[model samples]
Target: MTAVQRPVPLSVLDLVPVSSGSTSAEALRNTVDLAAAAERAGYARYWLAEHHLNPGVAGSAPNIVIGAVAAATSTIRVGSAATLVGNVRALQIAEAFGTLTGLYGPRFDLGLGRSGAPAPGAPAPPALEPRDDEVVDGLLVPSPFAFRIAPGSRFALQGELLGRVPGDVERFDDELALIRDLFAGTYERDGQVVDGTPAAGADVELWIHGSTGGASARAAGALGLPYGANYHTSPGTVLDSVRAYREAFRPGVLDAPHVIVSADVVAADSAAAASELALGYDRWVHSIRSGVGAIPYPTPAWAREHPVDPAVAEAVADRVATRFVGDAGHVADRLAVLQRVTGADELLVTTITHDHAARVRSYELLAAEWGARAARPAAVEVA
Candidate 1:
């Protein structure tokens, strides 16, 4: 009920990061605790993000975590920021979420990330040349950073390690279609009727996650599915992503475009305190971008002592710049700007710090500030 106090509702996206010197068991416990705290703090929904082979992140299985989170909270909707198309079968996704709905009722958002094949009839986005940050309506839309993993790198070998071969990978579009059909209980393959079991009748909302004006955005638009643009992950391309989706939009599942945008944030009792907590973020980001999986979040002190390679740091520089870090009120104001610039229907927050308590406190403080925003701005400034 209190979620309505803000100009726009705020939701949470958790990576369930295991901090330096923390165990995965403890991290999982924190995930459950944070979900409960978020519900109590009046955030709209809770989303768990998936990561593979991350030493610092414990949420490799977001669906399983979603189940645990859903069971612990009473009113908040729980689901994935994404359950990877490359990782799970469409049938598996349907059955798993279908089963979740059977147990927890219909309060779920089955958000999916772009993987596998592009949607049919959707052409690739014309590549936007990467450039410096461009200010639009006061929001900093940085240049898109191209993510690469050197061939033969451990990260590049993940598919092989996962027992996946190129020829065996399922098309993203095919899985999406099959999932919809399965949910409708009308799926058939080779003249044989396909059943989604409990999933067939589940009322879970489907969503598409995108970072650019690419096929994913087009597909979401064409299908009229809810689209979540990643300002937090791809600040440079988020505008392009949202614009593309809206441009391609056709009435299908939703009568109009429904969009959510995400941001990286860190809040503390004071702006100085928040800046300190967020100081180590670049090192954590570098770990992932460097073809090594996420290392446990580095303490600010450790980060200062052991600086990342200059090139590595430079690559993730935009993320460091884009993070909304400050005191509760300060962070809240920035989030409002983000929502406004992106014209987001809702805002998704993902915060990380070396300590679990600090991370939890960040969400709590932001929630309090957001709820107290009686003088929020109206109307969007196109980003």
Candidate 2:
């Protein structure tokens, strides 16, 4: 028998949620505290996500939040769960992340995604058409509707809110090309070279975050960049996305395919306690899905008293159901299964609760249990 490999690393994905009756300032402070805790707990990395115009989420600017977190912690990698590349220019992103890498050295990563980060009340863009060469289950296939953002949905309105003219937002592939060129110091427009000075030689790790088996996955594969599948957001498509990524993989920056999978998790001392902590999750998800934008995270008592409407509850049941909630051992068991199913090189856990203490404790418990499990030896029988 051969020796078993080391356990996959565990990381954190924080939304920096503002609880009911809490201010954004307080939410940001809590984010700093959580990052510090994650670093102390032996977690591999700490990532903040970008969400604009959401009252409950304080991470509207992930790069800024990343700077703050990096300052507060001495170790543990810091980065954006994603920077919503679609809303910003390639040169700007290249410079920003390059500067971050400069200050933080090898401890910074740049996670890019196509989210538009639309502001409230902005008009939505037309749905995206799938590429003709997209791969599905080991086959190259065309999906006319592979990616669709509903009209008037928050995501569809991102370009408008960012002051982009209708149809001005560059196609994702073109944007990626520009970003690569800028990073490699080969960017040119109209025969004039463009340079992203400090970022040109920065050794920052690039990861693509995607929820579908479309362009994002394919791009990451072909470029040999790490891919992060959003099981927390699109559980139904996680497998397909990872599959698409591995299938299209080519050796570039990375020698082989590397994938990280994100999940929703809430752990407590007991199953009952965990369930209580999770009560507010369904309602919180409802606010986002309803397209009115996310409201402040409600307290457990408030969530118990103000039950979600049946229709709204049904709409978000799949997401709520996928969340891992229980004691540390139970949650770890579930996460292990998820890792096995996804074949993820790393696991990114995101937890949102009304109480910041509970949220921090959840990470502590998970890290302890996960570390213990990884250290345990495989049982063997003498023949």
Candidate 3:
């Protein structure tokens, strides 16, 4: 198999363990330890995902955790796997990340997602206003419409319309615009480059993460930000979404479009051992597909014995199970295939395992297999 010529930077999605037996402190410590190891292991980035009110996952506040992890490690890039921008105000996101950018320079990345961090006792996040039910009923709900509206009484709405902008839509746009301005303003206003940039105002690297095409891609393209597609759970749509993004891409914020696709990965010394590590993750993926509660990682035997429902099982199984589990050769081959299929400049890997040591080892084995390429060289010569 051809080697994945692009840099294979080992990275982590720190969900900080939230199992029944683990404590918050322990979770935090795990993040610290993981960050330190990732830095030492030559990983390029150590990111925390935003989730809320779920006992099975512990990354409720990505910013807070990012700060802690940043403090604990000297070199590895620290940032959010994503911040739930659809839930919080954009300025707040800017401020939090701006602070990190100030402290860490170009090493900080802000990945934005539309999903919200649900409150502990809250229900699932409010669907993006127009859901399938509303769509099927031909509901005209509201807008900031995608296209310009005419003054005529009739409308040709293909998708469900939500409603008119009752409040400040600029605030919404400003959320993003402001962040950019603030980043630039910090340097310009202060007359000093705090981060690495020689000019004023912060230019924190920005990325928009999405599971679909359309608004997210358009926004990222227009803003000149990098794009991260969520292929870890939505594997089927990866190619289509990426194609749409590249096709629709127009340079506004970025000189050229950059796309990263996330994937579920498992690796071990042998394919069987890697398969063993993947069983619990398979079950977890099964639960997500079935809309069941997020459960703790299960033993490989337990997962194999408890067959998931047949309806969503195939899709879940196909994406979640690793073809690369056996050993180094197997993982390298699978990754090469993934790189070819997605043209992913980078891969954000997510792994869920019951044993903490095994989880660390999984990436360690893969990094070892990727051999010297995975190892971080001397620091880049920053200006």
Q: Estimate each model's TM-score.
A: 0.91, 0.88, 0.74
CA lDDT, candidate 3, residue 331: 62
lDDT (tens digit, per residue) of candidate 3 on 54-125: 446677778888988888888887888677554566566777776776776667888876542222222332
- Model 3, position 132, has a per-residue lDDT of 23
Please give the RMSD to the true structure for each candidate, in Å. Answer: 4.5, 5.1, 10.7
Candidate with better lDDT, 1 vs 2: 1
In terms of TM-score, the best-performing candidate is 1
lDDT of each: 0.85, 0.81, 0.61
Worst 10 residues of 3 by lDDT: 153-162
Scored against the true structure, residue 201 in model 1 reaches a CA lDDT of: 82
In model 1, residue pairs whose N, Cα or C atoms come closer than 3 Å (at least 3 residues apart or on different chains), thus clashing, are 117-172
lDDT of 2 at 186: 86
Q: Candidate 1, after superposition: displacement of residue 357 in Å?
A: 0.9
Q: Any runs in candidate 2 off by more than 4 Å, and if so which?
A: 1-6, 116-157, 165-170, 189-193, 379-383
Off by over 4 Å in 3: 1-7, 104-106, 116-174, 186-200, 289-292, 304-315, 321-324, 373-383
Candidate with better TM-score, 1 vs 3: 1
